[model samples]
Target: MKLQCEVEVINRMLPTFGMRNRGKGTRAVLSVGRQEGKRGAIYLMICTLKDKAGSRYKLENNIEQLFTKFLGEGKATIRLKEPALDICLSKAEMCSLKNFVSIVGLANKGSDAGTPLLSQLIPAKTSEIEKPRAKMFITSKKDYPITKNFPYSLEQLQVSYCKLARIDMRMLCLKKLQKLDLSNNHIKKLPKTIGDLICLQELILSHNYLESFEVALCNSTLSNSLKLLDLSENKIKALPVQICNFKELISLKIDENDLLQLPFTIGRLSKLRLISAAKNKLSCLPSTFKMLRLEKVDLFGNPFIQASPMVPDIQLKIPQTLLETAAREVARYRIPYGPQLIPATLCQDLSMAKTCDCGLSCLNSFIQIVVAMNLHQVSQTVVLVDTMGGTDAPIICYFCSLTCYSHFLDKYLQSIRD
Candidate 1:
């Protein structure tokens, strides 16, 4: 999902696989069930099975030209270029499908062929059967409700593209849940009990209305195991310095927000491998941002001045493939650029120069008159953050003097709070 693609393709390939056909795709289900070990199941459904006539015939054997691997599932993350097929199957039914072979009339609509297949593969009564602990839980639909009761044994739960706003705090009962996705929702805040799910490793809350973090999320127990946190496409203004609580966080995405600045405490997350903070109002990053060995760092949309320390060696663009840990980079990537130049000086080019929050652009730099310049007790400063290195990070100030920087700082904070 990282590499943007059209949902129109899903519509084209699955014009019939709508809500009405959710659990009613009996023939389509059997066709997929018969090809348990055989690969290209998704490609077959998308490309080969164009219509009912296409799906009725058995899948071709010459699949050398066609290819798709069943990458291990985790939270049902569908990376770009990877085809995904949806189905609903109980654990027992899944166990029985391994030996199922496709029969002549089994996939025919309105035929009795499916009765024998189901009777043989699935037990009639699941009442007395002992259900296995849940490993993967997936439900994708718009306006889907989040139930209060969920199995504690679940390792992955994907409730993406739903209209859920508030998740029941009882979900913290899942002591073993590893991956949780509540993306594409109207959620404003997370439950305080979310901190109790210490086993959560990858949490995706992207495309929501979250303006800030839950106080309980700063707990060390949850931070110790939470590796990936995606908070992109939200209303977040700035991340608290307490976010450094995620001691094991490897990737952090706060893109598409109203963020004016990032807390210096982020440097405490030594395990952080990537930072996606594009499309924010940030003028500069924290001093310690350049100290880490990040695989990817995105700050393309920020109005960074020349004093910012972030080097331009890394590309701001997301790789065509998945992240390195999730993809194979077969070739070198040419990261795209989006105007990585500092604003012009007022004395030089007014057209390109950025005015200070105080409405004055520093045109001259000479002597220092602290008291006269409102610098008696001022610590805040402003300057153009450097996009390609050469920033004094220990205390990054984008201004030529401290007074203007301090003035802007107070205004920026107040704006975000409102």
Candidate 2:
């Protein structure tokens, strides 16, 4: 809603509070607009010069304080701050935190321009005082409202570290959007509708609770123009082979995930220039990795018992690329040596208990069924499965193995054909 900080520099994004000429002790104003046309309140700060020898670095310290304060406020005109970060800060830092914006319930007034903040510049209501004040509010930046006009001609939308968990499809219908960043949110899943952004080029959904990539359901255009895809620091365990469809990808980041493997077609990304799979559980790379047109790669902190000792030697250097390239040429015609394979019989330990006649109970992973189905119904149909009423009419069959389930399901489908 509002912020106070010491100004160390005069810049366009940050106003000098008309005190840039005042030098060292002047406060700076950072006024961010919500809508494209409207102006918002400015962040004012009183600069204190403890040591003026070098204060530019100290200006960044103010930015840090600004960040810490927004996170401290439980709610604000905009929501920011990760709750997990609070654990590491000391008591005094938390104590120094204060939310600048305020939230006022105005049922009679419109929700958008309903509550105008009262500060030094503007001290009255819109009806009583017609002066133009900054359109600002104190609300959860995480829960920041998305108006229909917010995405008008918008090309990039970044909500990183905003504590946001989901994309508002209504606001995401913008036709011009090229990039979307939702990093550092606690989001558990991505809306398949994200594929609807026909012009999207970059998708940064890093550092969240996402466990897997829903490749088949996403839109076709998403992969057509995408160049940078950062899914690093998520809970991804395995990626679908369809990810190779992102032929335009220049960089891919899947680091710090639970991933033990990548699709064999990963190397099919002919345009991929860089890939970072650091801090994952990968034991070996895909056999197709030899086909990658990569310029750089990072694969540190993995378990590769039978892997080539060259793993530790996989440093970022031109010579290493040449060496790997030469080796890749030799291995191109040979069978891929990476990505360990497990026999079907070894899949017995895992099972998915179910209530349907589709014989899905013995399946090992949802992706298996997702691959069979169109892949867009999981989120929509989960509720129906809970509310279905016809289950009382049947005698259920439980299969001991995936093969048995597949056999039964196939037989049942064939029987229906008769």
Candidate 3:
């Protein structure tokens, strides 16, 4: 009888199981019957119970089962108020309605969904329900001492945005912590015992007032596990040479700092891929920097001077020889009160001069006479002249008799031409 009833219920629910109009309270029943001479009837219902009392009782029993299996023998309440049978399952003399719906579409014709349902139905094993891990937060007010005694057993800790004046992290005993974030804080220094976090993988100390890096971080164990480290926006001028000891470090950011130079040990970071040292006071790079297997480098705002022993072609094209020769000639013959004379060694030309003489006779006679004769030589009576064929040739002078003769020749030539 129970088998017949289960078959009938399954058939009824099968056609409408996947249908939209089957309604929420529709039940899918599975019943088993005695093969020979069994007396009692058994029925199994698998669906939501509309009766509040019956639904409550089933929920409470399931909760009890869950606690006993997962929480190590715990007690639970069981009571139900209403019943508008949705899905039913029957086996021998047992019958129960299941409220939870499996998202995977029901397969009445096969046993594909049964294994998954049974697995989920079995409560978690006792060994699986371990104590929950704790969490840590930085809630200290500004200017307060950052206490190290955290309240929770944390696997990860985030202490950002806490305006802490001083950090005493030595008191922290977080052995299980795997990650720590101290970004955007007012931390000036890290405790020397920071290496205590043997299990830590990622540590972020960006945007802080750290004037120097923690020396304790040089520990080989910590460096091996530390994969990412960010120390950007700080007052750090130089990184410790031990930084290259981080054999496992992949990414490092030290941007917006006062770094003047990087240690050559940077080449030891064989696994380093990304590095940022922008906005620094770096004037030159280390030769070992070529050893870096970098994809990109930001070297802006650095003073670079490209120098070579050989003069450039552009400088060779300039008329430097002519300029030097003219400068030298002018310097050798210091002509005063006429075409303001420039020294030969000077690279530029002179334009004007300030006369010291005040009298008109001094200006007209002396200045004019000097200007007309091009008398560059200063002597007692007669000015000397360079009568040499070439402009740069030696200077020479003739007596007053020769000067009169030169005047006679100039007059004779002019008369003949007219």
Candidates in order, TM-scores: namely 0.45, 0.41, 0.40
Stronger candidate by lDDT (2 vs 3): 2
Per-residue CA lDDT of candidate 3, range 1-418, in tens? 1111111111234445564333322222222211123222111222222311111112211211111121111111111122322332222111221222211112222224333332212122222222334565664555333453453347787777876545545324776677787888888887766777777777778888988886668764678688778888888988886787788887788878788777646767888766666676665444334446754444444333332212211212133356434433444465342434445423223221111122111011111111011112211222112223111111111112223334534665687699
**Candidate 3 root-mean-square deviation in Å:** 29.8
TM accuracy, model 2: 0.41
* Candidate 1: C-alpha lDDT: 0.49
**Comparing candidate 1 with candidate 2, which one achieves the higher lDDT?**
1
lDDT of 2 by residue, 138-241 (tens): 12475465542452446777666667666667546766778777777788887787877888888888988898888753337778888999999999999887
The C-alpha lDDT values of all candidates are 0.49, 0.48, 0.44
Model 3 ranges off by over 4 Å: 1-131, 134-152, 168-171, 303-418
Candidate 2 segments whose C-alpha is farther than 4 A from its true place: 1-143, 146-149, 217-219, 308-418
Model 1: per-residue lDDT, tens digit, 169-280? 6566888889888788789988878887878998999999999987568764777899999999999987776788888898899989999888756656788877777788
